[model samples]
Target: MTRQRYRQLRYPLIALALILGLLAIHQYRLYASPVTAQRVQTVTISNAGFLPNKLSVNKGETVSLMIVNTDIRPHNLVIRELNVQSSDLKPNQSATLQFLAEQEGQFPFISNTPGYPEIGYQGTLIVN
Candidate 1:
């Protein structure tokens, strides 16, 4: 091809190459990265304890445990086996615990602070 003709085509080719390169990278990331389905569950804490005493989820899912503290005292929720816990939540406050449910079993969560779990600040997590 003539020099002028080649010059006219060079930038377009470079641009096309760049676009293809970006698309390839995007495709690689889309498939290579692990896919996680985000799950959000809400449990309320009152004088009685966790609103829903029973919680269930499937394996390989990331769970967002949204805790709404609606009691007169502070409470902390924890699932020791799952390595998930929450900070002390004052009355009417809320906290979120995000964790990956990697194992399949029944995990029990209780209040980390004393006198709470025994008083009913507890629940069960069934992972299937």
Candidate 2:
């Protein structure tokens, strides 16, 4: 190729090579990282409180808790031990709380919404 033609193609060739190198690095990282299977648990919220209030899981497992609100007012769920909290969900709305169950013990979760009795809206997560 002529010198002028080479100059015109140089920048674009460098950019293409950089883009390909980044993509190859990303693919390598995706494959080299460890993969953990997630465990899903559904908790329904109502005036009566959380259904199936007790949840059990193994230590080091990831948990995806789907909280569905079927009540007339908004509410949120909180797990103090795991530092997990859900957004205020309106009627017929839902939110998900995900975290790694790293500790082996019983963690309590509850709805802190006003006017709801703490005793009535409480549950436990048992990790073994």
Candidate 3:
């Protein structure tokens, strides 16, 4: 096409491209899996061990746990089944763990911080 025709068609072409891009995004969102809510559950770690240690959530949902280590020594939160482990948080330190609950089952978590587990630093995460 001539330069004049090309220039005249440019705006329409750009508009078409924009519309196509938006349609692609909309289609993707329609076919995509629904996003789970960002819910947070806090657990306090101290001499008393995990407060409300029996955590529960729905399957296919996301799990976000705020682990507050209120003890003088560092502690770790580990879920062997999910291979999820939190850092050895120092005294009064806090950490957050986020993961998808892909499976439905009862998973046990432990603290691998030197006798912490034996001291009652154990809990269960139930995904239904």
Q: Estimate each model's TM-score.
A: 0.70, 0.88, 0.71
Residue-level lDDT tens digits of model 1 in 72-110: 988889898878889988999998887778999999999
Model 1 CA lDDT for position 9: 99
Among these predictions, the greatest TM-score belongs to 2
Clashing residue pairs for model 3: none
Give the whole-model CA lDDT for all candidates, comma-separated: 0.87, 0.87, 0.89
Candidate 1, lDDT over the whole model: 0.87
Task: Give a tens-digit lDDT track for model 3, residues 1-128.
Answer: 79999999999999999999999999999889576557899999888888878999999888899999988778989998998999989998899998889999999998997745656888999999
TM-score ranking, high to low: 2, 3, 1
| Candidate 3 Cα misplacement greater than 4 A, ranges | 1-37
For each of the candidates, the C-alpha root-mean-square deviation to the true structure, in angstroms, is: 4.1, 2.0, 3.9
**Candidate 2 whole-model C-alpha lDDT, 0 to 1:** 0.87
What residue runs in model 2 are displaced by over 4 Å at the alpha carbon?
A: 32-37, 115-117
- For residues 18-108, what per-residue lDDT tens digits would candidate 2 score against the true structure? 9999999999999997555475799999889898799999998878899999989888889877899998889999987778888899999
